[model samples]
Target: MTNQIYPCLWFDGQAQAAAKFYCSIFKNSKITADNQMVVTFELNGKKFMGLNGGPHFKFNEAVSFVVDCDTQEEIDNYWSKLTADGGSEGTCGWLKDKFGVSWQIVPTVLPKLLSNPDKAQNVMQAYMKMKKFDIRELENA
Candidate 1:
């Protein structure tokens, strides 16, 4: 294989299904390749490879994909779609989908707002109370 950096996700025989689901959620995404052993796909221009490695490996929150949003509507849209159907919510804008992959849906302005030492605490406090980030609240903080 060529030397290239890409996230290789392990799935228990659900690589293809996971790739399709992810493609449906993100724009400019598609499955580039698929077979019995592996599935390659792209999300927002980033490439990922999913391996049908079976149940020997399982997903955990130690690694997560962060989806940055520019507006509350965008945040809401991602939150709803990602947490739909058997997904569960976690604190600080974290969630796990049906496949057990963790995701962090956050506002693009979050880092900027939190970068200010004076307002960082307030912004963090506001985000702590929210499952889905609210841009207005962060700005007010």
Candidate 2:
């Protein structure tokens, strides 16, 4: 047996909306539970519960979901879906959804470049040139 902790996100009456949005963006994703005040969903096999715990708290960048994508198409797809509605884009593939949930939609190769001493600056340069990540650009950089 393994012990793992999942994130339970608190929302201001938008738990269901968040769950649906997330499920639509990810493959093999679905909502496991739905109620007036709570919704549970799985994204890329990681489970999360969204709680409609009223407007007492708001989501911030202190915690974020980092989506590692393999291709530019995947990155674009996620970025477009997640940044829809009132969401805003931030630097380095970071975005805040309509519900103020922070997300980082990055290419899977980013870690490889960042971890490589020789390619770190080139990768950073590529990242700086993009509002959304492009794997081809990073690879060429």
Per-residue lDDT for 21-91 in model 1, tens only? 99999999999999999999999988999999989988999999999898888888888888888989998
What's the lDDT of the predicted structure labeled candidate 2?
0.89
Q: What C-alpha lDDT, on a 0 to 100 scale, does residue 138 get in candidate 2?
A: 84
Most lDDT-accurate candidate: 1
RMSD of each: 1.4, 1.7
**Per-residue lDDT over 1-141 for candidate 2, one digit per residue giving the tens place of the 0 to 100 score:** 378789999998889998998888888899998999889899977889999999899888999999888888888988998899999999899999888999999888888889898889998987997888878888878
lDDT agreement with native, every candidate: 0.92, 0.89
Clash number for candidate 1: 0
* Reference-based TM-score, model 2: 0.90
Clashes of each: 0, 0
TM-score of every model versus the real structure: 0.94, 0.90
